[model samples]
Target: MFDVPLMNRYGLLAAAMSVLLCATAGPARGEEISLQKAVEIAVQNNVELNAFRKEEGLREAAKTKAGLLPNPTLELSLESGALTGNSGENAFSVGVSQEFLLAGKREKRLALAQKELEVYRWQLADRERLLRLDAKARFYQVLLAVRKLKLAEGGIELNRHLYQVAKERLAAGDIPELELNLVQVELARSEGAKTAALEAVLSSRAELSLLLGGSEVDPALPTGPLEAGGAVKEAQGDLFRLALERRPDLKALRAEAEKGSAELSLAQAEGVPNLTAGLGLKRDTTTVEVAGLEGKDTSYTVGITLSMPIPLFDKNQSGVREASVRRDTAGSRLAVAVKRVEREVATAYASLSNAEQLLSLYLRNVMPQLEENLKLTSEAYQLGEVPVLTVFEEQKKYLEVNQGYLEALNQRQQALFKLEAAAATELTGGVH
Candidate 1:
């Protein structure tokens, strides 16, 4: 009678109840924060996300750099025969040259920078999506720990009551010392379980504190239901479609493909050599001795010149090739991302379905009978009608059944979190 399979089958359930109780105790040490609050804190204060946001500034600066024109060149020259001992012969020229971008290279470069900025925005959004998911998961873990602590406390109360009954029976000469000793042992075990459950609450809260960027000494208590109401109403195929439409990582990859296309276009534009035009004023003063007579000549002239590279060999062929490869690689990655999302949605969908089924079983069939059974068994044992072992078994069943119910609740919430993360879209009726 002491070796009941029902209690053993739901051992994990009891652990979860103990966690819940401990969570309740946590509020006394620190203020309570709801799930939404936790998520907001994580998004705002997380160090990595803050650092990643700086990239937006860098991308914006790149756009400014891309749109700017090349600087104008200034040229000045003096030609003299002084070095050759003919200082009387000298010339001076002043010129300004501007290299004009040809084939719309500047516009193409600006377009590429814009596409790059889009890709980074999507990437950062995806990172925030992941961060939100992690915060929710950690919050749920703390909730589970609190529930487990509650279960442990309940167990202790039941064991203490049973111990009193056992002592009474032993004192009345109706039971042996060994039976009473068994109840004391159970009571002590319950106390130890409570201690462990309390420790679990602290550890879970510490984890959540780290995620929320809070001090561990003052970790906020999670304030929400362990069994928050939510359901997955969409079919697997529909969820997969939603993932394709909403997943930021997938969006980032598509943006990257567009960026690669822009890069290729820019590379082709760069292959067209730029035109440099110059305008200059020239002055020359020359002196010469001809026919034994000294003569001097002074002249001034204005001229315009235009020049360009021949592009005989390197026409950005390597750059074009690299960009083409990049575009192809991006396309391949997007295809792979689609497949991976499909698998994730399917897996999370099935997991949610299974958790719901288990919780339904506990709610409709098993849990309602457990309390009455334990009550009757306790009364019968006290009246000397049932064996002490029967009381122990029933009490164990009571605690484990409650534990199992909470465990199912926790598992369902965990499944919901995974589904939301996989799809990269918030689902209705999820933990709040």
Candidate 2:
């Protein structure tokens, strides 16, 4: 008994050690992720996407089941009664029956099921596209927040230096105390803005983490700057064509139309009569005295029976009509889907072109000039050729321009994401 207890204790210790080892090894396996990795994680772990995947699995199973034949049925019967005031008679019967669907009923059902599966397939694809777009948007927002925070920090630094200069000038009787106090006030405000910008960066990072399936991410994550390389030259027609051909929503609508056609076929098939055939055997016995033979027994041979429903009152004409109406409705909906996708593509293309132009203007003309002017103003202040206030105002202008440039870049990235989403293409060369 002591040996058994000792073995149990050692086994427990070994199991505990194994668990500890696994725990220690887990984090090492955690991936050093990029934007594509984050998007993949979101696609895999998002609850809505997972639910849709499960629904697709169920639809596939339904499709498989729909292709199978109907189940055969078994039947039995027994009877007993007194006859001829002498004795009792008994009868027993057993039968097996199966209904054969007419007019391609099984094939129609299978086709409908297959069309439904396609709908769900396209639904999953659409979800993937939307989720990736969302991830890209959030990723760019985080980058923008970081850029703004950096700009705010630079402003704070410049303001602090100006505050110190103002204090020295006041002490040496070169500037009024009120001027120094005003600089100190501006420095404090700059510090506050910097703190707010830092908080915004952290918040944006947290939001990105949630989008990446609740995985923690570094607030200082690096992102590639937006570049305008693939802007559509002839936007309207090409975008419309791409949207009509590749958009998942349009695909889903087309699938619905196919399903509706299948349903109509199935309803028409239902109007045809289905045949049920059965084979049975029966035995009968009777006891009588006055008849030609007393206690007679009889056996009936097995025979086949066929059945079909009469088409007097209802031949499923109404069902076929309803299915026809539904098919028409589905066709109309698909048309609407095509038109909607075309409009969306046109809108996205227009916005993308506008954002690209604005971004180019900021990059080429405004930001470079602002940087040079800020430098000149700083130098002029150092040489006492301009007042300190001029230097401060020019510094503010530089920071503002830089912030605006970052915003324009972010807007361009977002527009690109939307355009790709509309076109159902990968803009980043990989999914994001």
lDDT of 2 by residue, 1-432 (tens): 122243443343344334322321221222244566667777887777787788877998999998999899999997777544435677788889999988988988999999999998988899889998898888778667766776676676667656655555565667678888788888888789889988987888788787776554653463544344565554578767767778887888888888888999899888888999998887777666575656666677687999999878888989999999988998999888777787778778878888888978987898678767865675454334788788778877777776777777778878878888988877546421
For lDDT, the strongest prediction is: 1
Q: Report the error of model 1 at residue 170, Å.
A: 2.5
Note the Cα lDDT for every prediction shown: 0.82, 0.73
RMSD of 1: 5.8
RMSD after Cα superposition, model 2? 15.6
Clashing pairs in 2: none
All-Cα superposition RMSD per candidate: 5.8, 15.6
lDDT of 1 by residue, 1-432 (tens): 222243432343344334434533333334478888888999888888989999899999999999999999999999999999888999999999999999999999999999999999999988888899899998888888777887788788777667766665677788899998888899999899899989998998888888777573264588777774767777788888888988899999999999999999999998999999999999999997999998889999999999999999999999999999999999999999899999999999898999999988887888667655765676677667999888778877777777777778888998888898888767874321
Q: Quote the lDDT for 381 in model 1.
A: 71
TM-score between candidate 2 and the true structure: 0.86
Off by over 4 Å in 1: 1-31, 216-219, 289-296, 429-432
